[model samples]
Target: MAASVTRVFVSHLAGLPVFDPGGDQVGRVRDLVAMLRVGRRPPRLLGMVVEVLSRRRIFLPMTRVTGIESGQIVTTGVLNVRRFEQRPTERLVLGELLDRRVQLVDSEEGATVLDVSIRRLPARRDWEIDKVFVRRGRGGALRRKGETLTVEWSAVTGFSLEEDSQSAESLVATFERLRPVDVANALHHLSPKRRAEVAAALDDDRLADVLEELPEDDQVEILGKLKEERAADVLEAMDPDDAADLLSELPEEDKERLLALMRPDEAADVRRLLSYEERTAGGLMTTEPIVLRPDATIADALARVRQQDLSPALAAQVYVCRPPEETPTGRYLGTIHFQRLLRDPPFTLVGSMVDSDLPPLAPDTPLRAVTSYLAAYNMVAAPVVDESGSLLGAVTVDDVLDHLLPDDWRETDFEESEHG
Candidate 1:
């Protein structure tokens, strides 16, 4: 630690009030974001997520944060109002890293991470995680029987992804509370061998969710390392469109081999998605949208929308078809937005409330046209209908945005001066 540095434990700063230069309260610190480095390097402090007066969480970069002292945080008063979206290179300290199990580098003794300390770098605007407070014990930090010690970050061995199976399990346990995207972000920072080990430890459903968020290369690498049978299971668990996109990156023979191992129904959905152009509506649509029959009531629609597995865009509305409720459903009747379900009586039939004024997208619609349609109609998702007017699936705004952004966008680092 440098002479000018004053180490502050993150636990003490968790709910500290943040103020502008004028001393007006802006928000309270909800969580700190840090960028984990490869190997044993200390993670760099990125910024903190603050809950503002309106309860909207926003990113407050470290550069704009002038001081953290006197049980308060003082900033330059400049903040980005856009909701903070964690990138693949970042980690939420409070939410993910706390209470983790690690080991002492020299003694190789098991230890539990109680807290970590951050200090401003010498003669620079940067900050880094410098110290780790740990308890040497067989159980977690909650047990007071172990010897507590404060050590330099490098003195810890189990924090890195390259640790053994036990350590990997601890890492997985630490990530259990995070969203799939956050878990994928943490994985992106690990070495190939270690990344594969962690991915293997995750269950089929969890691994499928993580694979969807990972870049194509990482997805291919992790999937390649799994047993062929397991890989098929994971593919089956992923959304049909995402699974198809991943399969497209593999060699023709390998793709076919995996597809052959998958369940017939799941493979069929993926195969249909694969038949479309990579950048077309058919290629980007997910076959698992909320689908209902005309006779379904508003209550039924609301209940389907409440599914925990659905993405916000997918849950934003329900597609009403005639006979079959699944994709490639009977003649596409219309769609009912989520708001309509809340407005109408519970007994109202979804068929009578369908909003069919907006034309549905065709399977062959180009990606550019799909983008324009969503923008023009203020829709989060647009239905895809085949030549027979059978509902195929839906293309969501998030998927379109994923395709429209630069290929390396997920790996791009956020600059310190971004807020300044």
Candidate 2:
């Protein structure tokens, strides 16, 4: 049976003093030994080193210990120190962490770690007190291995974070159900001014991506706190259509102020989208779609997609639209999945790969129609155009998914992060 845990103190056995209830001189506390058994449980009896008369030393089991103090471990009754003998099990202490890769638990999750925690056991007055371990990921905050909220030692009632596959499977499940809007809601809890500051710190494109995730109302609230120039910089980074929607949501004076602060080219593009009805294709499209030439090589098409730096946005499906040589604008070609690009020969001409059978939507196409077209065609993005099939822009899947996810999704993400 494991010994009861109570307050205990430790000191050098040879230097410390101990005495019996009758005031008879007793042996001093010395070294401590903990068992190192692989696969089998460690010994329940914690041992201590003792030094006595005639220059003799002995190992005493903690189970035999009766009294403890800041400086001494008084035996159940004082006796000759030689009565206890050292065991072979005491020969090896657990090695340095780097010497062996040990399996341990972390946050109730299985974590491969560099070291484990150890401290004196209050009840075990033997050599080295042994009971609870601050296991490097070995023992600490014990969440359900992968819970969104990680509670500390004080909050933990009890736990058994297994260091195995069960722990990893739980983490994977939590990740799959995680959503972006949950992230936005948690970010919303911070003051709008703080949010704007964070937005400003992000690159133009990243800021735009975050803005897209935010609700229109929240987007305006955050932008309202930023300086007009900074707000304009973020707007310029967003898709022209998205910027127009956000601009429309703002007070007219704020919109005009931000537009005035924007770069001339960016302002013009946003203005063009803003002129369209909010419900139309032109109003919901992205102006940054990959517009490739018919004569371009597969490598050139891939390079064009790379320039956008759109990670985690399903960039594999790049829109193959107009060529630069075409008069006012070339005919809008079909979109290609990134996987197809990789599978085909690098020398292949992009024109041969164009799938003209793609469904087309005009600038005035309704939102419902665009969404249906995306679903029916299984396209990552559907190019929106005019009567002449001129490329207006493309509607990507991420924008659609973001629109569908709830605002509170960000909260889940915030709660999941350990560092946060």
Best by TM-score: 1
114-138 per-residue lDDT for model 1 (tens digits):
7899988877778889899888976
Give the residue spans of candidate 1 off by over 4 A: 1-166, 413-420
Give the runs in model 2 whose Cα sits over 4 Å from its true position. 1-183, 192-206, 311-314, 325-328, 402-420
The best candidate in terms of lDDT: 1
Span of ten consecutive residues with least summed lDDT in model 2: 92-101
Error of 2 at 133 (Å): 27
lDDT of each: 0.85, 0.55
- Model 2 CA RMSD to the hidden true structure, in angstroms: 22.0
**Model 2 scores what on Cα lDDT?**
0.55
